[model samples]
Target: MDESYFFKLKSVAKDRLSPNGEVAFFLGILLYSGALLGICFFAIYYAVDFKKTSELFKGLFIGSGVMIILLIILFCLCVLFEKMVFKIQKIIGVVTVLYTIFIAYFPFFYFFIYLA
Candidate 1:
């Protein structure tokens, strides 16, 4: 028999107009690093009160370390191309900053709640 027109392949063009989310990724990096630096500063400042705030600083350190690890993992994923960058990256960074801030002041929250 004869195969006149069976199947055909079409060439696909690259999408040049769409955003690559580099801005989001850079913003995430900025926010993550800034928060981490702030945590370090607070931990250092509270080191003088070793008796009362040691546990608080310890928790902050641990939380910051975990956050750093997670951000590193995200960086690696971005490098691997397995996941494309998006606004969620910036949201993650913002959430990390907020979460760390909340954790750092947890003891104060307890104190304020107890007072009020």
Candidate 2:
């Protein structure tokens, strides 16, 4: 069986470039941390209504906090497993990409459904 072109390119890059996996991993950690924090802030901001509290907003606030804590735990584990830097980077990258898609999709979806 023959390897795909992308596989060949990646192999060549990995061998010759000696990519800084740790840097990638740390960058991903930073991004995920920032995103979680932002979401937490937004959720809490929306939920802060003593007179009228929405169950959905309260749930979002709690969920965001939990996610942030979980990410912190994962960050600690990534720091401990420094040798598995590439795997950590890939995990974070995939997560960030998915989150980005969701972030982008919601607003456009609302706009299309309500405005258009």
Candidate 3:
């Protein structure tokens, strides 16, 4: 009886970690970021009708905000996909390196543009 109890306990302990831990964390981050992005989108969307209401303003307000939010979401999705599978990771890895290079090179490009 004791052996069976121990075995049962061992089996129970073995699976303590939820199988979906990574997915859970990913979703949590997605939900939080989505809320944040939604708010920023709303703020910019409203800015259209709220234009005369605020002193500081930028045209294409919604466009810029949406683009930024999308980029952020894409980055997050890419990371999640990378974590979920190595095949996807290789693709995301390439994309990530390209993105990093593009971002890194932009300063030089800007400097050149400024110099020119």
Best by lDDT: 2
- Which sections of candidate 3 miss by over 4 Å? 1-71, 78-87
Which stretches in model 1 have alpha-carbon errors above 4 Å? 1-19, 22-52, 82-116
| Clashing residue pairs found in predicted model 2 | none
Candidates in order have lDDT scores of 0.51, 0.54, 0.47
lDDT of 2 by residue, 57-115 (tens): 44644654565466566666766776665656677666556545544453443233222
TM-score of each: 0.39, 0.45, 0.31
Better model by lDDT: candidate 1 vs candidate 2: 2
Query: Model 3 reaches what TM-score against the true structure?
Result: 0.31
Candidate 3 residue-wise lDDT, 37-89, digit = tens: 46654554565344443333333334434544555665566456654533354
- At residue 2, what lDDT does model 3 achieve? 78
> Which candidate number would show the highest TM-score if scored against the true structure?
2
Q: In every candidate, how many clashes are there?
A: 0, 0, 0
